[model samples]
Target: MKSFITGASGYLGQRLAIKLAENGEKVHALIRNPKAVKTLEHPNIKFFFGDVLDNISIKTAMEGCETVFHVAALARVWTKNSDDFYKINVGGTSNVIRISQELNVSKFILTSSTGTIGPSLNLPNNEETPRWSSFNNDYEISKSLADTELLKHAANGFPGLIVMPSRIFGPGIASPSSGVNRIIIGFIKKGFAVIPKQSGVIGNYGFIEDIINGHILARDKGAIGEKYILGGENKTLGELFEAIKNRVNKNGLVLKIPVWPLSYYSLFSQFLADRFGIEPRITPDLVKRLGQNSAFDCSKAISQLGYRITPFEETIETTIRFLSQSEDR
Candidate 1:
């Protein structure tokens, strides 16, 4: 069957498209960047230059495609243009869902983020987790709203399923989520960091291949209108630093910073951003988010879609290797 994917130029979409093509499926990759056309070379893959923001482009690329993976979104924590997040994440999703329903595609998978799940301090979040009052940044807020839109539409007979992935890591395409690799490298290169270890802020992580597998499984077996979280290991910043230190052969230090200090720093960072158009390296939203526990349970995905999560240690090695090689190039 032919598949159409939005954000095919992105890390997840790129990996998904390549996998589909290698499996001998016809894949149409909707890309906003024209230069990406040459990079996505594959026998079974076709590049369609289009933006999800454009209704005509969506209709054109999705025509005759049996499966649609809406993977594109404004992924950064902050951008100079904030409204683009709503326009692309929410508006774009709405258009895709409408077109998919109109075309009656066999499956429509809306890629959502686990960022919508929680700032839960003690309890681990799951698919049943309630909406969060706090967000990491604009990206999370827009994505949360977009996810809501998908669920609302699904309740009204939209043939769509939401696949929420948590802290996905692996090789291929230096996309937005690949920032985790930089964080890893920094820990390896520099000695360590100062953070509030006691703060409940943490996350569940999964490798790219396993995440791709999760999406495929969800498409094949997921119940319509359901949201499935594709996640694996839950880890805190201190734990993550230790893992990196071990992987890179180092015994580093993790200095614990108070939450109030970080919040104060974020305020100064935001000031620079607003006055000089400089994107803040730290934001109050990010500090607040990083202070919350992001542990999640993917039992529903595991039981329903037969999802298998690769251990986080294994993924760290894979990611380090990829980043190292890319830097060498």
Candidate 2:
């Protein structure tokens, strides 16, 4: 099998590509940066430089591939320009769908997010749960729009499957650079002494390997136009931090600050970060999102795709070990 993966240099995409290669599939990765090409160098993997916005680029990279994994997106909480977010997340997704249909690719897998579903009030969120209008940030909005568009295309006879992963917590093949990774690193470095009070939100955490396995199973058994939630066990922020603290054998101070004050602080921090052209350590949107529960249920994926997730504690230990080794090096 020949597989094409967008965002191949990303945490999830890179791991998925390597796993596919290990499974005896030829992998072609679409990368935007020349420097990223070196990261994907493997015997069964080839890199193609392209942007998802350019149809020609996507088409060229997708040529002769039986499966296409659309994993690229503008994942950010605070962006001054919503246009960039929409252009990359929604518009880019549309292009991928169109090209996959035009190329007659047998399977097109979308690496969507549980953010599209938002917080569940009465019950655990399933794929059939109705999306809430209160999606916090531009990133979530764009992903929701993209997921809606993909569903529309699927209804029109496009062969597509969506895999919605919760908070991904396992170590990546490359270095850690995402929000989750930052939290882990901060805790390890004793930077996260104060635990915010408004963090009652239960985030579902999944290991990257389990998520990739879920994607592969979805490709093999998922019905066209169907969506699956490949979520792991859900836990609160405090519980998560405690787990990490136990694993690292350290006791970090925990303070519970109200959401309103933190939100204001996040806004100021974001403003400063934007002025300096740096990503903020915290954003207002993120602060607000942390106050809402983001739990999900993956029973459908479990029954249909045979999806199994590692325990959250186990994933945390593995991530800390990987980070410790990298730090030692």
Candidate 3:
């Protein structure tokens, strides 16, 4: 398949593109930075440098593509600029749907988030979970809105499938820069006497390879206009950190702290961000998510798309090895 992917330089998108290229498929990736685009080294991989806001750029990149993977989005829990989230997530998604329809592409896969199912503390959320009015952050709100829009069009005969992956982590080529990787590395490397222990929330973090494979299955078997969540092992923050610590063969304290402090830090960080252009490392939204059950039932993906996920311990070990090697480079 001649595939066209947006956000091809991102953590998931880059891995998806490389997998396709390695399999001898022609791939065209839309990346805003020419420098990042240069990293896709496969002979079958090509790139276009432009923002999703520019229809001309998307059109140019998507031309002659049989399958369209609309992976681009402004993925941030906290941001100095919130408007970009709406623009990139909602507006950019609209452009991709419009162009894919114009071209009559066979498959248009949308990479959404399990956050669209909204937050839960007891039961695991699923694709059919009703959305709560309260969202985790601007990014969640924007994606939920965009996913709604795409499904609305699907109801009106839009041929698109939405795939939501929860908390991806694995040996990404950009492992050092990936969010989950940072958390794993920081927890081990920092050697803190104790780490924040969050028992309230359950997170379903999947391996990157399984997520990529899930995408292919979704492309082949997913029902039109339906959403499938490719999630992995569900565990609390404390369990997650414990798994990492054990994988690293180290013993550290898992400290349980109140969310109030994280909330306060978010406000302070936002102040610095607003005045000095410093990005907030912690935000109220992030804390809220961390304190909620970000867990999901991927049975839909598993049963419908035949998806399988790697174990958490195995993924952590791979991440550690990749990060250790990256330090040399």
Candidate 4:
């Protein structure tokens, strides 16, 4: 079997590539930068330099691959250029689907985010939940569009299965620099002591390994044209911070701020970040998102895909351990 993965150099993609290779499958990793090629080198793995926005690159990378895992996307809380988010998240996904269809891949697994499912304040969200009118951020909106595009293509006879994962936390293949890595770093450095006032908002979390496992399972047993929520435990931000504090043996205060005040602060932060072309530490979208309950239910995946997740405490321990080792290095 052959597997072609976009964003194979990313945290989840790299792990998936390794797992596929270890299971005796040939893996082709699509990366845009020539410098990133070395990181994906292995006996059973090949690297292809390609941009998802470029059809030629995508088409070339899809040739002879039996399974395609479209994992690459613009994932960020705040960005100066919102157009870049759409280009990479929406346009990139379209290209991947088109190329997969052209090559007749046996299965196409899309790495969608649970962000699109919106806040589950009243109840746990299932795959049947409709997209919320209020998107948390541009990243969420772009992903929702891409997910819709992928599903549309699937309806048109493309073998697509969407795996919607919640906020993933774990060690990275290359380095722990972004995504949950940032949070882990912050926790280790005592940067998140005070729980923002939106602490009551529910957050769904899954370990990277568990999320990758869910993706593989979705590829194998998922029904074509269906979406599966690959989520795990739901806990409040305050609980999460407490877990981190316990793991690090640090005492920190969690100050709760009202939503309105946080929103204004986030807006100011975003303005400053955009003016300087730097990533915002906080954004209005993020503030709004953090104020909502983002819980999700993965019963379908649990039963159909045999998906199981580690306990939240265990996940936190593993993450902290990985971060500690990385810091030592």
User: Which whole-number lDDT from 0 to 100 does residue 21 have in model 2?
Assistant: 89
Query: Candidate 1 — which pairs collide?
Result: 200-292, 200-293, 201-291, 201-292
lDDT by residue (24-117, candidate 2, tens digit) is 8999899888887666778999888888999998999999999989989887676666689899999999999999988999999998999889
Put the candidates in TM-score order, highest first: 2, 3, 1, 4
lDDT of 3 by residue, 131-223 (tens): 764876788889989998899989988879899988888876563225677876676566542334556467888888999999989988999
In candidate 1, what are the lDDT values of residues 168-280, reduced to their tens digit?
Answer: 87887776676577676666567686677563457887788988988889889999899998988888777776777777646776678778888898899998988899989
lDDT of each: 0.83, 0.84, 0.82, 0.82
Model 3 is weakest, by summed lDDT over 10 consecutive residues, at: 191-200
- Judge candidate 2 at residue 193 and give its lDDT: 52
Each candidate structure's count of clashing pairs: 4, 0, 0, 3
Estimate, for each residue in 24-96, the C-alpha lDDT of model 4 and write its tens digit: 8899888877876666667999888877998987878788999999999877776678899999999999888
Residue 123 lDDT, candidate 2, scale 0-100: 70
Question: Which residue pairs clash within candidate 3?
Answer: none
| Off by more than 4 A, model 4 | 173-179, 252-261
Segments in model 2 whose C-alpha atoms lie over 4 Å from true places: 173-177, 273-278
